[model samples]
Target chain A: MPLDAMTDVSDEALLVLFANGDQMAARALTLRFTPKVMAHAYRLLGNHAEAEDVTQESMLRLWKIAPDWRQGEAKISTWLYRVVANLCTDRLRRKPGLALDAVPEPEDNAPGVTERIQDHTREVALQKALNQLPERQRQAVVLRHIEGLTNPEIAAIMEISTEAVESLTARGKRTLAAKLAGQRNELGYSDD
Target chain B: MNWGIAMTERKFDPVDLDHLFARVREHPAQPSADLMKRVLTDAYDAQAAVTPVTAPQLPGAPWLLQVFRELGGWPSMAGLTTAALVGVWLGISPPDGLVATADSFFGTDDDAYLIDVAPEATFEIAEGFLQ
Candidate 1:
């Protein structure tokens, strides 16, 4: 089947196609997932280069398991999220001192408008604050707030109860709010 | 601009938290081309690794079994076996006219026992031993 027609195909269906040796399915899955997984990794690890490595490793694992992927067992994106989170944890463990300092600075040229610069600053600030959180709290908060994933989905990715996810996110938010409270005026939130 | 010490104790409701979440969501990091390239390369490599390979033809099997395979496996071999048996049966109990035709083509059937051939010559050779 043509690649264009694959837009509506489910990830599981595309995986089936890939197991059957459809290279186009591989390309489709790659295009569909890389950005989301990479971004998720970036949020978890607070480093762009490490995020890229984790993203590639996570994707490679998906490809390796395609042939044996049992239908209805797990959503592909959920599995990828879990893998990215775990890989990020491993990377973070290997370099304990690596923190928000390693996170890339927000690019200044692309969002040329004045308001967007503030938004970028806010995002960069939020990421730095997130890095200060406990690993589980950071994962829960990013999956819940930043990624906009549901509590149940975050639970599945974190292998925790939904109630636990809620607790983590709530605490994470309070801490984050406290961290950002002092800078609200400087980040242009006082005018809001 | 610190909103005094009260800012330290303020609670951010869901509506307020949305402000921070929105910034990260709206400005998500994109996967670089280099990362995409590495992922694609891994995908192709992994696909090749997991693909099933046909097992090599079974070697060191008995010759008869191999011949059985060469003769189109079991079904066709059964047919060939039946045909061979029928040929043997036909040759053994041929039709009445087939014997005459075969005799005419390949001379008469002088089938005889060893004792019947040259009995007098055998008796003359034994006469000297009796004397």
Candidate 2:
């Protein structure tokens, strides 16, 4: 079957096939999950190159454990999400001077004001504000809001309780709101 | 306490905050193609290394048959085990046939025969004695 067609295949089945040494299954899984991981990493690290590295390393770890992957214990994407999050944290720690304010713009020629001023700008501003948060809070917020994960899932990914995830996200969002409040009007969010 | 509760009951509603924050989630950036390729390659390489080596297809033998062929055939192990058991049995119990052969080759008076034998003893004498 074509690699792209494997998108409909369940992660559990791909994992089983990967465990059995099916290269196609491995490729299928990599193609399926890499984008999500890379997007998460980029949001967390704010550096496309570093995010790419983290994504690669995270996927490599996934592949390395494929043979021993146990189904029903946890979702594969969840495992990958956690791994990428941890890797981004490690990268952040290694370079304390790396500021979150330095997120790169897309390479495409300068987008028109409408394109530039779209919802993505808000997302970038939110990501920057999120980066200013403590690591746990940032992770909690990213996992909960950006990733659209349930509180329980976020808790599991962060290795914390659901309550903790909720608290962290709440605090993180409050901090983000305060930080981004100045940009709200510029980002087209002002009620006036 | 009731007065304090009434005083503290009023706070900024979080719904406004939720509404404002809702736009923050709208446009997540897509991963670049280069990044995607790197991740997929890494995952593929890792899976290749850790995946178990199952039997491969061959023209002459199916996977199972190839496995059996690699295992040196069933009869080989049985033959080796039988040989080992026979060797153990022979080691514990000396072979009567060998003992009989040795006895026939060297008769009861072999000691006297050795004593009488000399470097100069002729082949003729030995043949005559045997006859």
Per-model fnat list = 0.75, 0.52
The alpha-carbon interface RMSD of model 2 comes to 3.1
Q: For residues A1-192, what per-residue lDDT tens digits would candidate 1 score against the true structure? A: 554368988899999998888888889999999999988998988788788889999998999899999999899999999998889888888998775634345566765567766776777778888888889999999999888999999998889999999999999988888888777777777533
Q: Which residue ranges in model 1 land beyond 4 Å of their true spot? A: A1-4, A99-112, B1-10, B13-16, B52-131
lDDT of 2 by residue, B30-106 (tens): 66777767766676666666654655577765877876767776787788789999988877886768657766887
Clashes of each: 0, 0
Which predicted model would earn the best lDDT?
1
Write down the RMSD of candidate 1 (Cα, Å): 12.2
Estimate the overall C-alpha local distance difference test score of candidate 2: 0.74
Candidate 2 TM-score versus the reference: 0.68
Q: Chain A of model 1, TM-score against the native?
A: 0.89
TM-score of every model versus the real structure: 0.70, 0.68
TM-score of chain B of 2: 0.34
Candidate 2: tens digits of C-alpha lDDT, residues A1-192:
676667777999987887677767777887788878877887788767777788878888887787777879998888988898889889899996666545445556665746554555666676677778898898888878777889989988888899989899988877777787777666676443
Q: Give the TM-score, chain B only, in order for the candidates.
A: 0.34, 0.34
RMSD of each: 12.2, 11.7
